[model samples]
Target chain A: MTQDETMISVRNIGKRFGSVVAVEDACFDIRRGEFFSLLGASGSGKTTVLRIMAGFEAATSGAIFIDGRQMDAVPPHQRPVNMVFQNYAIFPHLNVADNIGFGLRKLKLDPVERRRRIDEMLELIKLPGFGDRLADQLSGGQRQRVALARALVLQPKVLLLDEPLGALDKQLREQMQVELRALQRSIGVTFVLVTHDQEEALTLSDRIAVMADGRVLQVDTPAGLYERPCSRQVAGFVGNMNFLPARVVSQDGGSARIDVPGLQTTCSISAERLARFGSDISLAIRPERMTLHRERPADQANSVSGVLHDRMYLGERTQFQVALDDRGTTIAVSSSTTVAERLGSIDPGAQVWLSWSEEALIPLGND
Target chain B: MTVTSELNAPAGADKTAFAGLRRLFFQNESLRGLVLLTPTLVILSITVIVPFLLMGAMSLWTQIGFDYTDDWSFRNYGIILTEPLYTTLLLRSLGMSMAATLVTVMLAYPMAYFLAFHVQKNKLIWLIIITLPFWTSYLLRVFAWRVVLGYEGVINTGLMEIGLISEPLSFLLYSKSAVIITLAHAWAAFALLPIYVSLEKIDKSVLEASADLGEGPVMRFLRVILPLSMPGVIAGTFLMFIPTVGDYVTAALVGGPDSRMIGNLIELQFGTVDNWPMGAALAITMIISITMVGLLFMVLSRLLKRWVAA
Candidate 1:
């Protein structure tokens, strides 16, 4: 992103809780009008990073800048950022309008202006005529919207959301993901979301920062992170992945000779896919990229023969767990349409060959 | 929604009262609940409600041989209220109780808030220490204060030995201030526990939300913490005020003649003066006054809630 369009820049941020490091050397930039997400599991330091950016937590050793101004010493209340907490945290004593207008009340906005903005926000969140309703009277989705309206009504330079859809049901969560993104786009303010669901990050964010064990593994666009993972951890985290350990035998012209176990012939992977020679190498492929067939196909470059160990029939797709002769397990997910047309039917202990293009299999670094 | 509403409707308004009675006896969980609570209710009625009703009746009659069956009259109430000394003592007791409750709450709120929010893992230890005095006898606790504030006590002796005073202070143990100080120390835990429970039950995320929305610490406490804990404050004040008004030990032990509370006066009327009717009337008056003040607090809290919301 351009520096002029950068709204919040986190530089070398880290946090420690007693002897446990929560976030380590975390750095990312949020564009002025883009929705960015930090995706990780529990205890992966995603929330700690967001809290440091929001100034609720001070970084152990780094700086946070908003609009190019240093904010290391700024307290959370003084920072030009507002957060939509995971629990919605709507002030229970206040009605919906007062909750939405709470921050403006602190700014000493005119009473008439405050009322107008509160009404506008309630309508924006599609809760018109709900100003007098107590927060507990609202449904889960309504409370989430009220929280969103409250955070956005401040018109802060950056809007931080911590698992903003966590309280809603699955359908409501999906719906709010779209609505929240659309609202962010229309408001033209930078949005930073933190979630553990990679699909949520992919669906709602312009860029995703995948975190694990208090360290950021990679930060890229969702497609880039999924397609071009830099490490084994990222590949396994972002989607269903299959890894086959291999040894680099030779290299020439964007293709490399590799000895993949469970097959007699040495395979040729793209030389561009290689990280370094003599490293304990592994080939990574997404489950959806590999195809299954009952009989071997003619002239397919990378083909593996294995017995199907298990099969799962999801509503829209069929997943196969295949066991190789001398190697570990590999899984493949195929749509039901292919199950009807190509393979006809599937069962355990059936012989199958899994084939994929050389470029589809990404070679990941040991690090 | 229709199914749930139908299922939730109270059992058959169309049914006969006898059928309703049968349903209550045979089918209702609430009846079972009441059955389980019957013994406690019986005990409370015999120990508390029956005596309270008897006192209410006695307040309206002339006392004959410690009984109210002789004559029904409001003469005792009329005499008690008309007496300037009695009314002054009643008012003084009310004022002192109010002042003591105020001082106790003001001191307890910060300590409770600190324990609830800032003490973290060691909070239960601090709470136990705050409540440690209550495990001992109330009379012993009052006597302990005598040692702290007596003329030749630790405070006076230390000050005099340090050459800070030529004489031990006589004003420390027998004045109205002494009564208030003694009561405050004695009832400090009573006021702190309810407030602490209230503070502890509040969602810390709400405070975090306040700060996230740009509210300062003072503003957050005023707007969120204080109002949310009003129920506890109301409960603590009621807990302190009701018993303190009728407590004779603190007054008799720590107060001078002029500082004697309504409890001391009532005890004198019943024990020394042989005026049972007037003492009953005074007890009735004290109960009514406390009930009125408690109601006023409830109303004030409700009004404050509305005012803050508005």
Candidate 2:
């Protein structure tokens, strides 16, 4: 997105609580109408960055601009942003309609207009006739919807959600993930979600900023972040990445020849990798990208013979852990249930060969 | 087959009846609740209900000399209604109790809020300190207030030492305000705990949510904090008000002649006046008045909450 299209611009923002730094020198631009997520593990300062953007916290250094307006002196209430809190903080004393209409009171909307807006919000949240239901009486998912409606009713320039679906069960969470994405698309409002759930970030976000240790490590589209992580940390955090220690032999442009001790071969690394030549780098590959076969695959460029150490039968896929002969490093390989069934009776401790294309090998930075 | 079935029917009926009885009395929630409540109910009947009923009966009897006449009448009620002294004392008691409740709750809420929100370290220590006044006897606390508010007491003596006043303030001690002050201090602990509990139970995220929705500090407190804390406020108000209205000690100890409350009159009737029936009548009136006022306050608060939310 262009500079003028940036809805929220975070400029080298840093936050410190006493002696401990919560977030450090983070800078990014969230585009207008984009569903952006800050994804990280706990204590990784993702939520802190979201809070700073919402003006709930003051950054110790740097500045934040919402629609090009500096938000340093703006109080949270005055900022053109609203938040769906992690706990779904619906006012227990007020009914659903009152809770949703809380922010509109200051605007002095007429009674009929207020009712119309509340009804519109209720309908938008798929609770068309639940305006008078007591807040405490609703179930968890219903309360979440009410919280969303409450924030959306204000028509904020950006909506900040702090682990909004963290309290939900797995099935409900997945369902809400799709609903949240659809809701954002339909409204076309900028959404900044902070969550530690990698699957949630990948599913809901248009672009995800992977954060670690109070800093933004990488910001890219979900597929880009998963397919090509800049460092080993991001690669490991995003998905089930198998990292094998490797020594780069040589480099031609962005592509490199790397000697993977576990794979027992000099593999051709993809040109997309940014690692330097003759350096100790790590070869990372997604579990699903590698396939296991009982016989040696003559056509494959990268292949290793190993003993199948363990096998787990998931409903749709079977995960095989193979212990390579060289260095005795164990690598995980996954195949679809149908494929595993076709190659039947591949027992643990049986000899197997793991193979993948050269493009499947990802060269990651040592750190 | 018919004879055998007929013979077995009675035994089957008996088994079902026993099972039904067990379910009704033991397994059922409502019946089980009643059964569990029986002990407290019996105790309350003996300790509270019996005395109240007897007092109600006695209020109707007239006491002549040293004996209560068997002839039931409304003589004491008539005296209460017609006599300006009794009516004035009752009104004064209500006003003084309300003043004490208002002051106590106002002072206690901020202290409770501070304890609940501001103090992060050694909260148990602070709570114990807040309740430290309760360690002393209630009468002793009243006496302590007397010493502080006395003509030559702490305020007057300190003012004189500072050369701010040449004479002791006579109005500091034996007035309605003095009774109110003494009673509020006596009930401070009671007022603080309930309010503190309500404030503590408030979810911190709710405040943040309110702020995120564009409410400033003052509006946040009014729209969120105050409404949520109303239950404790109501509890604290009644806790202070009910007992203070019937309190005789503070008024007797610090009140002037003109500041005598209905409680003092009731105490007098029960003591030197030897008019037990009249005292009983006055006690019933106080109960009825306090209940009426309490209900009115509760209804008003409920309406106020609705209005505020709207």
Candidate 3:
């Protein structure tokens, strides 16, 4: 992206809390008006990165810039960024209107304009006439909306959200996710969200930075990260993937032939992933991509015979755990319940065949 | 149908009777709570309420020589309102108590803040140390203050020995400032604990949120910390002020003739003056005035909160 497209640039930022290294040499650029997510598990330092960007924390090394202005000397309040805290931190003593209008005080707006802005924010958050209600009077979802309104009312260049929807119930969380994405799109504000929920990140983020142990493992679009994870760790973290030990037979140009001992077949990997990580690699396949059949299909190049060890009936899809002839390896295959019904009564102990296309077998870096 | 209705009537009556009794004493939470508090109510009525009512009754009667007359009159209250001695002493006591409360709260606030925010370990030890002075007798503490402030006492002796002063100062010991200082020291723990509890109850995130919203440290404290800690401040004020207003021992020991407060006058009427009715009237007046001042402070603090929030 060009300099104008880059809204916030975090450059080689590192933070150490006494003996613990919270964030180590993290570098990334958030594009303007993009919904970006730092996705990680707990202790992955995603929140720390968001805090540093917001100027709540000063990096022990390197620097952060917002709109090409160095933020090292700026305090959080003075920075051109606002944050929606995880707990929503609505001032309990103030009514909803005052909470939303808090940042407006620093702007020194006239009463008419301030009221107009606050009312506009309340309406945007779907909370008209809620200005008179106190913080304690608000429910969890209401508080979340109020927090969003409070931060967005300032119209900062960038808005940071630290697990903004982590506190809601599953249903409310899903609904808010859709609403939040729509809100971000309509306002065209760069939203940098920190979350451990992969589904939430995948659904809401335009681009995701996968973090682990205070290091950025990969930065890609959600589909790119899920479909073509650069490392085995990212693949495992992003979604369920069955790994089978594979040996590279040959490599030419961008394609490589790999032998999967568990599947008992040599499949062509249409990518040069084995060259960088060497011959000892794992063939990763999503469960849904593998098809299960009772009879061996004649045209299939990659197929393995196994016995169904377990069957899980998930409402839309049924997952079957298959034990191959190889002693201790089990691979899961998921099929639509409609297809399972047409296949006619496959018991747990029944024999099954699993097959997939060559493009489904992704050669992942072992490291 | 008529036979079935008649058969159900006795069972329904029995159920209603049991439910009524249960609702009165057990089913309703407030009524159950009142039932559980019966013992405390009885004890308080006997020990406090009965004596207070008797005192109020006595305040309207006249005391003649050794025996008290049964004639009920407002003569004691009239004397209290008309006599300059009673009014002056009451006003002096009010002023001294207010001064003591101000000094105590101001000094205790920093200590409470330190204990709440800064101290990470040995908090219980610090709390115990603060209350250690209370373990000593109250009279002993007053006397210790006397020793510290008296002529040729700790302050005078130390200053003179160091060649800072030519002679011992006589004004330090027998003065209103001495009484105020002693009362403030005695009530420090009372003021500190309530303020500390309030400050400790403040969610740390609220302060961080304030700072994040563009408020500096001073503004954050004024907007968040002070308002949130108001309950403890009010509690501490009442804790220090009400008791100090009626304190007789400290005034008697540290205060000279001019610094004597209404408590000393009440003590004189009850003891040396042999005027029980007048003493009762003075006590009643002190209680009423203290209660009124407490209510006024509460209202003022609430208004201050609203103003600051706005």
- TM-scores for candidates 1 onward, in order: 0.91, 0.93, 0.94
Q: Write the per-residue lDDT of candidate 3 for residues B1-310, one digit (tens) a residue.
A: 9999999999999999999898777668988888889999999999999999999999998999898987999999999999999999999999999999999999999999999999999999999999999999999999999999999799999999999999999999999999999999999999999999999998886776777778887778888888889999999999999999999999999999889999999999999999999999999999999999999999999999877865
Per-residue CA lDDT of model 1 for A1-367, tens digit only, reads: 7779888888988899999999999888888888899999999999999888888788888888999999999888898999999998988888998899888867687889889999999889999999999988999999999998998899898999999888788999999998988898888888999999999999999999999999998999999999999889999899788877767888887878887664434677777667453546877778778777788967465777888888877767777788876645555645465563567767788888877776776777755
Off by over 4 Å in 2: A252-255, A270-278, B1-39
Higher-ranked by lDDT: 2 or 3: 2
Clashing pairs in 2: none
Tell me how each candidate scores on DockQ against the true complex.
0.51, 0.66, 0.49
Question: Under CAPRI classification, how is model 2 graded?
Answer: medium
Cα lDDT of model 2 by residue, A1-367, tens digit = 6778999999999999999998999999999999999999999999999998888889999999999999999999899999999999999999999999999989999999999999999998899999999987898999999999999999999999999999999988999998999999999999999999999999999999999999999999999999988888899999899998888777788666778888878977655554342388888999999988889899655788999999999999999999999878888988899999998888889999988888888888788
* Candidate 2 interface RMSD after superposing interface residues: 0.8
In order, the TM-score of chain B in each prediction is: 0.87, 0.90, 0.90
TM-score of chain A in every predicted structure: 0.94, 0.97, 0.97
**In order, what lDDT does every prediction score?**
0.85, 0.92, 0.91
DockQ of 3: 0.49
C-alpha RMSD of each candidate structure in angstroms: 7.1, 5.3, 5.1
Which candidate number would show the highest lDDT if scored against the true structure? 2
Please, what are the lDDT tens digits per residue for candidate 2 over residues B1-310? 9999999999999999999999788768998989899999999999999999999999999998889896889999999999998889898899999999999999999999999999999999999998898998888988898899999999999999999999999999999889989998899988999999999999999999999999999989889999999999999999989999999999999988878888999999999998999999999999999999999999999999888866
List residue ranges in candidate 1 displaced over 4 A.
A253-255, A259-279, A324-333, A336-339, B1-27, B63-69, B305-310
Best by DockQ: 2
Candidate 2 predicts chain B with a TM-score of 0.90
